[model samples]
Target: MAEDNPKSSVMKAGVDDAKWYWLAEGWAPGGHIREVDFDAQMRGIDPLFEGIKIVDCDTHFTEPADLWTSHAPAGMKDKMPHVRRIDGADQWFVGDKHFGSIGGNVIAKDRNKLLGRLAFQNYDQIDPGSYLVAPRLAQMDAMGVWAQICFQNGGVTQVGSLLGLGDEPLAVAITEIYNDACKERMDASGGRINGMGTLPYWDKDLMNQEMRRIADMGLKGITLPDRPERVDSSSAYVGPDGKVSPFWAEVFEICNDQGIPLNYHLNASLDANSAIWDNLGFDQKLPIHALLHHVGCAATLSNFMVSGILDTYPKLKIGLIESGMGWVPFWLEAMEHQLDEFRTRENRGLKLRPKEYFKQHFWVSYWFEDYAPKHMLEEIGVDRVMFETDYPHPTSLYPGVQDKLVETLGQHDYATRKRVLQDNAAELYNLEI
Candidate 1:
C-alpha cells in the first residue's frame, strides 16, 4: 500500500526534492518573487506638485543590442552593429572596431558594485528598466514623474562610432534604424515618453532628411554633438576660420522653421577620454575628470552665442542637457564681460549680451543640484531653467526622488516651482502637458 502511494512518497522526499519545484514557481524561502506594480504603488502617495504636472527634460534610454541588426535590411544586416564576446566579455562591434561593453550603458542597479569598475560586462547584470519602455514607465511612476525626454545611451549612440565606419550609406541606415526604434518606444509609451532623434550630422543632406523624418515620427528634438568637430573632424561648424558655416546656418533655419529644438548633451562629443588623466595620480583622476564634465555643454553654448548663430536664428531653441546650473551665472558673466570688451574691436554682431540670449533662446537642465536654484535663479530667470532626473543613470534620483525634489524646490513660490518642475520643459519641448 505504501509503494502504491506515489503522492505521499513525494511529500516525504524533503526540502531537497522540492527545490526544483520552488525555483520553477519563482519562490524563495521567504516569499514568492513577483514583478512590482509601480502604478499601484504610486496611487497611495500624495502628489509632489499640487496641481502641476512634472516633466523631466533629460532622461536616458538604453538601446538593446538587437536594435539595429534585428531591423536591418538584408544588404545592411552584415554591416549593422552587433555584440560579440571578446576576452570573455560582451562587446558591441560595428564591423572591426569595438565600441564598448553592454555593462556601462545600463548601470542603474549595479552602480554600487561598479564604484571603481568600468562596467558589468553582461546584459544580465543590468536593470531591465534601463532598456525596456514598459518597465521605464513604471519606474517613472514610482518616482512621481509624468513624462520624460529620452536620449540614447552614449556607448551605443555615438555619432563618431557611426562615422568611423567610413561607410556613408551604412551610417545613415544605422541612424534611421535607431530613430525608428526610438519612435517605436515612444509610440508604445502612451505619451509618457518622448525621444530626441539622432542625426548623421556630418552630412547636410542626410541631416535635413533625418530631421524631417524625426518630425514625422512626432519626436520633439534632435541631438547634436557637444563638440561638432568631434563628429566630423572637418566640420565647418568649427575650425580656426571662426565663422559659422552656411551649412549649419541652414540647418538652424530648418530647426527654427520646423519648431524643433537642438539638444546638446554633456559629453555628447566623443573626443574626451580617460587617457588625458593619465598624467594625474590615479586617486585624483576620476574626481577631477567628473568635475570637468559639466563644462562641455557650457563650451558648446558659448560657441553658438558668440558665433552670431543665435542672432541669425532668434527663433531657434537650444537646450543644454544634464549640465547643472551652478556654473551658468559665472560663465554668462564672463561672456558678457568679454562681449562688452571685444564686440566693437572684433566686429562681433550681436544685439544682446550672451546672458540675454541664454535667457531667451537657450534652456539648461539641472538634476542633483540644490545650490544653483538658490543662487542663480534670480539672475538666470526661472523660466529658462528646467528640471531633470537623468533616470536610470548611476547618479539618477530614484526611490525617494519626489522627496528630494520637494526639499530642493520647496522654498520657491508655487508658480516658480511649477515652471522649474513642469512648465518650462512643456513649452520648450512643445509637450502636451
Candidate 2:
C-alpha cells in the first residue's frame, strides 16, 4: 500500500496544479512564475534529480497590490498604494506616487496583469496555461514529496520597515490584517499547503492578541524576521517578573499553551557581509543576496543562545526556515567557544551549555546544499535537521529534491533518510494529514 500523506489517489483533494495555487497569504510574488519559459530555466537544477521525493518548505508569491487600500480602514487606506483602473477592468497601477513607491518596492509592480506579464518577461513567453502547478506537481509526483510547507513572501515586506511608517496604530493594524489573511487564505487550503502567521514584534499587547487569534485559526507556526527593527540582539529589558524582555516569555507561554511552533524565516538583507558592498558604495545586492539567509540563520541561533533565550525557555521549539544547514555546526561551535572564554560578570547566572540547550530547543530547515560534516549529528543532532524544496523559486529543485537527499545520505541507513525527509517535519509541524 502507498503512504497516506500525499493522497495521490485524490488529486484535487490535496494540492494539484490544475487551478491557480496561492502559496502565501500576504502579497509578495516573484520568482519562477509559471507563465514564463521553464524548460531553459530549470535545465541547470533538473539534472540533479533522477528519482526523488520533494517537500518545499519555503516559497513565495506577490500579494494583490491593492490589499491595504481595499481591506484597510478609510484613514489608513489613504496611506496605502492608490489604485485606479486604466485601459480595462483588469488594468490598473498605483496612483499615489509616494505610497505607490512602497507598493512597487514591495512587488516591483503596480498592476497584477503587468505583474503576471512580467513573470514571463525575462524569458521567451509561454502560455500561463501551458505550465504551472501540473508540471510542478508532475515533478513532485516524480520526486515523491509527501507534502510541503509554504510561507508568505509579501508578508515580510515592511515588517521592520513599519518602524518608519510613523503611526503605531496603523502598523499594528497592518500586522493584524496580514496575519488574519494568512489564516483565511493560506492555512484554510488544508494539508498540501501550510501557511505561517506573522507577529507584531514591536508591540507586546498586539503580539498577545495576534498569537491567540492565529492559534484559534489553526496555524501551525508563526514567522519573525531575522532582524527586528527596534530590538537589538544584545538589548535586554525587564519582563513581568522584572526580568528582561517579557516578549519572549509571552511568546513561549502562548506557543506552549496553544501548541504553535515559532518559525524564524531568514531574509537575505541584514548581514554585515552586505556592508562590504555598501562600503565600496555599489549596489548591496551582491553580498546581500549571498549572505542574507545563511548569516541570518547563524545570527538567529547565535542570538537565542548567547542572549540566554534558550536557557530561559527550555521547552520552546523554534524553526529556522529557509536557512540551509552548512553553517550551523560552525556557528554552534563558535558559541561554545564564546561560552567558555567569556565566563565573566556578563555571563554570571546562565546554567546550561548553549549547544545543549539549542539542540533540545530548536529545528532548522535545509535546502539546495546538505554537505554537513559527520560530526554534525554528534554536535547538533540529526533530529534537529529537516528538509525543504523552496519550490518554484530560482533555487528550487522541485521534481528532484528527494534525489538530492538520497544522494547526500547514501552512506547513512534508510532510517536517517526517512526521518530527515518525512518524520522530522511531521513531528515538527504536528501535521495530521
Candidate 3:
C-alpha cells in the first residue's frame, strides 16, 4: 500500500486487520519482535516475491474470549479457562499459560532454547516480514499462499482438546463461539480468506443449529476432532444406547444436502487430562500424536465404512486434514484386504473397493514432511493429495517452504508439481480463483 519499502507495508494488510499474523510477536521460530526489519527481509535476505501462489491449508487465529465467557451455558465458563489480565488486555489462560497476548508462550517463547531443535530456529537468518501476507493478495505475494483455511486458538476452541471443558453442553458453546468468531473473520476478509468453523460435538440440537449458522455465514467448512470424547450425539462413545450417535448421519446429511464439506482436524490430544499439559515427556507430546494421527484416522474411517454410513450417504465428502500421506497405502491395502474377504456375502451393501470410496468421498492434506517417499504419488494418488504449509506451527515451512518442496519432489515433472501444490487443493476446496 506504500512505496517499494516492505517495512512500511509489513503490518498493513491493505487495511488495518487485513493480515492476521499470529506469530508477529515471535510465536514462530526465528522471530524477534524488537528486531524485525521488514526492509532487510525484502532487500538482503529471502525477499518476498510476487509470482508463487500458496494455498495455506492450515493457518490460525486467536479464538475470541466471548466464545467461552458468553457462549458457555450456565456455570460452565467457570470450568473453562477465563480471560486473564496480561499486557493491559484480557487474555485466555490454558494450562496457566497466556494465549492471544503479545507475551504468551507461543507468541514470545524463546525459540532457540527448545529441547527439540525446531525448524524455524534452524533457519534463523530468515525474517518474519518476508512471510507477511494478510490481505489475500499480499498473502499470495508473501508466502505464495493463494488461499488459506485457518483454525481457532484458545483451549476450548482448540479442536479435540474440548474434552477438557468437562461436558458436552459447554463444549457445544465453545464451538458456537468459535464459529461466530470465524464468521466475523471471514466477513472481514471479504471472501479472500476462507474460515473453517469448529463444530458443537456433544449436543445434537446445538450442533445442527451451528451447522445451519455456519452455512448461512458463508464459511467453507467445519473442523471437528477425530475422537468421540469431544463430539456429542450418538457417537460420543461406542455403546448400543449412546444417545443415537448416528447424529453424524444427520451432520453428513446436512453437509450433503447443503453442498458443504466437513473437515476432520486432529486436535492436541485424545485424552483430556494429558492434552493441557505440555511437559508430558517428549514422547508423550510429539511421538504419541505422530502415531495417533494415523491410528485415529484409520480407526474412524474403518468404523464409518463398516457401520454402513458411507453406503447410506454416498454423496458426502470428508477431508482428512494434516494426516500425512505415508499411511494412505497401508490403510487402503488393509481396508481392501478386509473387503476382499467380505464381498461374497449377500448383505454387503458396499460395492466398491475401499480405495474407491477414498478417491470419491474423501480428501487428504499433507504437511511438507521432507521424507515424502518417491512413490508417494502412486501410493496416495496425486489428485487426492493436497500440499499444505502449516504456517507458524513447528512443522510449517514458511519463508522457504515451497523451495523445500521443490528440492524434495521437484524432479517429478510439471504435472506432479502442479498437482501437489495447486490443482489438488483447488479441486478439493472447489476454489474457483
Candidate 4:
C-alpha cells in the first residue's frame, strides 16, 4: 500500500538518490573517505609565512670525501683526509687515525629509516644537497629559507684528531683546505649561504694567520668547538687557567676587530666517560646522553662569563649555535644568584653581573622550540634571540619549518616574529637579505 502511494513513492526515491550522492562524494557506508593528496594540499601558500624572510643561523654540510685530498698542497698530499674501506664500511682517515664515517653526516633524507644509527658510511646514501652548494640553495628556496650560516660536519673533529700525528704543515694545510672549500661554496651560493671558518686552534701563529685569511675571504664568522680540548688535548684553549689564555684572547680580539662573531656549536666535547655509557645499553644511554649535550656549552659560557672576556673585549660578539635558548634563562639566573651571594673584588673579574654581560655580548639561537620564545622573551630579550633550522641534522626543521615557526612565534606581533626569524640574525651576521 505504501509503495503504491504517490507521497510514499516520492520519499523513497529521495532517500535512494541521497545514497548515490554520498557515493559520488567518496563517502562509504562505514563513513570512510578516499585517500587524500597531502602533498598537493601542502602546496597551498601559507598566509602566516607570506613575504617573511627566514635566516637560519645554524646548518651543516658534509665535506666531499676528497675535500682535503684534492686541495692539499703538493707536498702534503699523503697527510690529507681520505676514505678507507674498513671491514665493509667507509671510514674517514686523517693522518693514521679513523676519525669518522661518511654515513651519518647527511641524514635528512632517510632520517626516519636510519633513526637509531649514528652515521652513514658512504656518499651514495647521502642527499646531494648535504654537500653540494647549488642543490642546497634550491632546497632552501623550496623551504622558504632566505639564508643559512653553514658549519662543518665531522670534518672539524677529524682535523682536530690529526693533532700530534701530523706535522704542523699538514695540520695547517688541512685547515686551509677545509676553509678554501667552504669559501668556494659560499662564493658559489650568491650570498644565500655564509660559511663559518674553522680555526687551527693548535698552533698560535697558524691560528692567527688563518684568522687573517678568513677575514680576507669575507667569511661571516668562525666556528669554535664547544671543547677545543676534544680536538687536541694539549692545545685545549680553555682549561684550569680559564679562557683568558693568550691564544684565546688574541683569537677573540681578531674576531672582534674583524667584525666576525665567534660561533660555538654544540656537542664538541666527547668525554672519555661517554664510552662507559655503552654499558647502560642504547635505550637508556640515548636519552641521557641527549640531555647532557648542552652541558659543555653551558660550561663554556660560564668560563667566558667569569673570565672577564666579555668585559675585556666589549665589541666581541659570540653566537651560541645549535644550543637552544630555553636553558639560558635559568642558567643566567643561577649565575646571577651565585654572583650576588659570592662577590669578591679579587675573584669577580666581571664588572657587570653574568646576565648583564650575557645581554651585551651574546646572541643565542633556538630551533625545535615553542614555549621558550613565548615565555622567556623578556629574560632572553627578543633582540638577542635568533632562529635556526639546524638543517640536514637529526633535529632539523626541514620540510615543515615554516609551519613549526608559525606555530611557535605566531602569537607574538609581526615585529617580534620578524626580529627572531630574520632581523636579529641579519644584524648579527651582517647579511644583506
User: Which of the numbered candidates is closest to the native, going by highest lDDT?
Assistant: 1
Query: Can you write out model 1's per-residue Cα lDDT over 21-113, one digit (the tens) per residue?
Result: 111211111221223333443342235576767888888776787888999987889888888865555566787766665533324343222
Instruction: TM-score each candidate.
Output: 0.82, 0.68, 0.69, 0.82
lDDT of each: 0.68, 0.52, 0.53, 0.68
lDDT of 3 by residue, 102-157 (tens): 22222112222222322222112222321222433353454445677776533445
- Model 1: clashing residue pairs? none
Candidate 4's C-alpha lDDT?
0.68
Winner by TM-score between candidate 4 and candidate 3 = 4
Worst 10 residues of 3 by lDDT: 9-18
Q: Tell me the deviation in Å of residue 227 in model 1.
A: 2.5
The TM-score of candidate 4 is 0.82
**Candidate 4 per-residue lDDT over residues 14-65, each given as its tens digit:** 1122112111111111121223232532232256766667898998887777
Ranking by lDDT: 1, 4, 3, 2
Whichever of 1 and 2 has more TM-score, that candidate is: 1
lDDT comparing candidate 2 with the true structure: 0.52
2 or 4, which is superior by lDDT?
4
